[model samples]
Target: MTVLYRRVLGAALDDLPPQLLALHDSADPRTWSGQARIWRGAGILSRLIGWVMRLPPQGDAVPVSVSFIPQDGGEVWQRDFAGHTFMSYQYQAPNAQPGIVNERFGMIDVTVAFQTDRDRLVLEPMAWAFGPLPLPKALLPTGQSFETQIDDRFVFDVEIAMPWVGQIATYRGWLLPTE
Candidate 1:
């Protein structure tokens, strides 16, 4: 009774999170947990609805266009770039279990930066909110602003703003060329 969680981004179907797959394995109609049951139900619905009206997942990675509006009322830098960017929202409730720790939780912000250099236009980020500030002066030889190069593959750098976790948390990954 194992269930494999799967997701398809664009035309490529990808595996789901390990936690999600585990939930499917342990799901039982007679003894199903609250949250796990909900997830199973939603997945079933997704399959049924998908047959009637197939819709694409909005979170898929795609080449997106961005217009750089003046943050300080400067000039606009609008250009077409092969990249994907995303943001997220989450909600949490206080723990009210007997004798358990109770706490108040608020909003969280996650910003992701991704780039695929199809056209190979080198773009540098001036202001970044999610990661450590100042690009670790050691990495830059000039001790000035950091520079990024566009290549054949996409690179992802993420900054998660969850005061609950930490003031600032960053994660970076690159899709290296396999071919």
Candidate 2:
């Protein structure tokens, strides 16, 4: 049977790395959940930032889920971390720049660069903006990494830091499709 893969982030479903595509192209789409060993970076400021974001306190494992719904030009990614939902809007315009995934976190515009590294697909934050004003990238501390294990499970590690605030928050976890 031929499987239909939907666009994720901004890359065409078929153009994505094979392994990465398989992860998103599951038998069921309505609901998916998994568990991971969640971790919060050290330092008081990092913990404070985590609290503000509503991230679960440093835990060995936590539950996460994503509800993906197709829209006119893109998809709605509603992510449930631990239990809090961080909603984001994603879309791809007809003439969008190559390798760019445009997303809106609340009112902030976030642009991410999508690329393939070996067998993994990586998403790197490129820029951010509020309304029509663009924010200086140099003033933001950002990091991104995503990889799929040999067994088909996925692992993600992301961190955001500020100049004097040091490492704001970092979380890493593995996830698998729930049957």
Candidate 3:
């Protein structure tokens, strides 16, 4: 599932438009916070009636863990680390109703990285709940053997080369948007 996710995300980024690509390139700017969106998905919906009755709010330092599977189907798995966020605005269902609902609020990032290889990359928290901020480069890994990115228009793309898989592979038209 992780491998499939990486491949799907990578394909999305590869198909972004030139203008959107520029937005993503300028993403690491001082005003970078405004360049991306933050998103938090939680809470359970009522099965009989579609509504968010109870919600699970995230804590100050939530653990974002990563696990890597060897390409050759080896038992030796490589694992990375954890990431944390303090208070992100919660997106809740309105009035606990099926059709009737209040609007939701959340943020998103132009590009989000979950580097499984600790030797490759690490993300250091900057700011949260207030506005988007630039992710420090020091926290990022040196080599780019595997990674992912999303464009300004919310178009995502990713690339991965594991020991098991020689290179990236997928069905054609993998990144095209469908209505």
Candidate that would win on TM-score: 2
The per-model lDDT (C-alpha) reads: 0.23, 0.63, 0.24
RMSD of 1: 23.0
TM-score of candidate 3 relative to the true fold = 0.17
lDDT (Cα) of model 3? 0.24
Q: Tell me the tens digit of each residue's lDDT in model 2 across 1-179.
A: 22223443334545555545656554344445666555565788877866665565555667878676655555576878777677676765456676567777666777777776666667787888876788888755476555555555656666666666676666676656556
Of candidates 2 and 1, the better by lDDT: 2
Preferred candidate (TM-score higher): 2 or 3:
2
Where is the poorest 10-residue window by lDDT in model 1?
32-41
Runs with alpha carbons beyond 4 Å of true place in candidate 2: 1-19, 23-29, 41-56
RMSD to the true structure for each prediction, in A, is 23.0, 4.1, 20.7
lDDT tens digits by residue: candidate 1, 1-179: 11111111111112322322222222222111110000111244433432232221223233333232322212122322233232222111133221111111112111211121332212222222223333332221111111122343233333322212221222232332221
Deviation in angstroms for 173 in model 3?
A: 16
Clashes of 1: 0
TM-score of each: 0.20, 0.75, 0.17
Question: Tens-digit lDDT track for model 3 on 1-179?
Answer: 22322232243433445433333222121111111111222212112111121112223322222222223211121211123222211111223222111111233221223333322122222212213554344332122322223342222222212232232211010121212
